[model samples]
Target: MTLEAYNLLGWKSETVNLSFPDEDSWRLDAILYEVDSQKSFYWLLFTGGSISIYLLIYFIQKDSLLKAIRKSRLLFTILFPILLIYIDVNRIEELIHLSL
Candidate 1:
């Protein structure tokens, strides 16, 4: 169950309350919002939470579970945080260099 599936099933919970046109946009919005902050700890917490959900799904599915989680952790720790920091830093630099 995704948000769309939840909506279809008429599960009007808090998570379902914040519906976007699509998943990609919702994720992008989440990242953008989080990346603007000074606290990378919040970013790590958010990323960890999302990964935990995916890890749960991986465990439930049960086909090569260990491999799936290893891959997920590798990408999550190595790529995700790097990309987030790179984008956030660039954005901050742009704002700092902006001329009035």
Candidate 2:
């Protein structure tokens, strides 16, 4: 579905399917925000944490992800959630992460 969406939009995308380490933030986020994955992945890009990963997004409606970026465009909105995200795509293990 994601690949098809990108193809239709004339965009090139390669997805990585790595387990999000031992973090718990994103999971709780999914429940908290009631996000619909059909359109977004709840981007959570924090900039610090060394041993764990966390996720955070505040949307549920389809296409709300794009809408958020359109309005904010802050570093916090894009690849920062999984858009699923956190800060510094390079050092994903360096931020305030949530875990169970």
Candidate 3:
């Protein structure tokens, strides 16, 4: 699925295998390089905006920071699964549209 997505996005990706000097387990890393710079720039901008908002909220609600943090965590726990489902559904919709 990941490879398919990378191919769809016209990105260059490679899988690398690494072994630790002392450990027996080997690790496989999928490196995706040569990504679209415009997408990367937009993602960085969105992440920065999210962090700025979080910091602003933390500072403004300093006295209730802990409470706010707890609430945020709870909200994330509740929303994350739904968000994942929505993303997956959107992906499937896109795939179906492409196939048709």
The total number of steric clashes, by the backbone 3 Å criterion, in model 2 comes to 20
lDDT of 3: 0.45
**Number of clashing residue pairs, candidate 1:** 0
Per-residue lDDT over 1-100 for candidate 2, one digit per residue giving the tens place of the 0 to 100 score: 0111135376856542333344654644443343233224422233321112222133223346666444444444444454443222222322222221
Q: Please report, in order, the local distance difference test score of every candidate based on alpha carbons.
A: 0.54, 0.35, 0.45
> By TM-score, who's the top model here?
1
Worst 10 residues of 3 by lDDT: 24-33
User: lDDT (0-100) at residue 54 of candidate 2?
Assistant: 24
Candidate 3: list runs displaced more than 4 Å.
1-72
What C-alpha lDDT, on a 0 to 100 scale, does residue 70 get in candidate 1? 66
TM-score of 1: 0.34
Clashes of each: 0, 20, 0
Q: Please write out the lDDT profile of model 1 over residues 9-82, one tens digit for every residue.
A: 66865332233345346444554454456367447756775876677577657657676666556456646666
TM-score of each: 0.34, 0.20, 0.29
Question: Per-prediction RMSD in angstroms?
Answer: 14.2, 15.9, 14.8
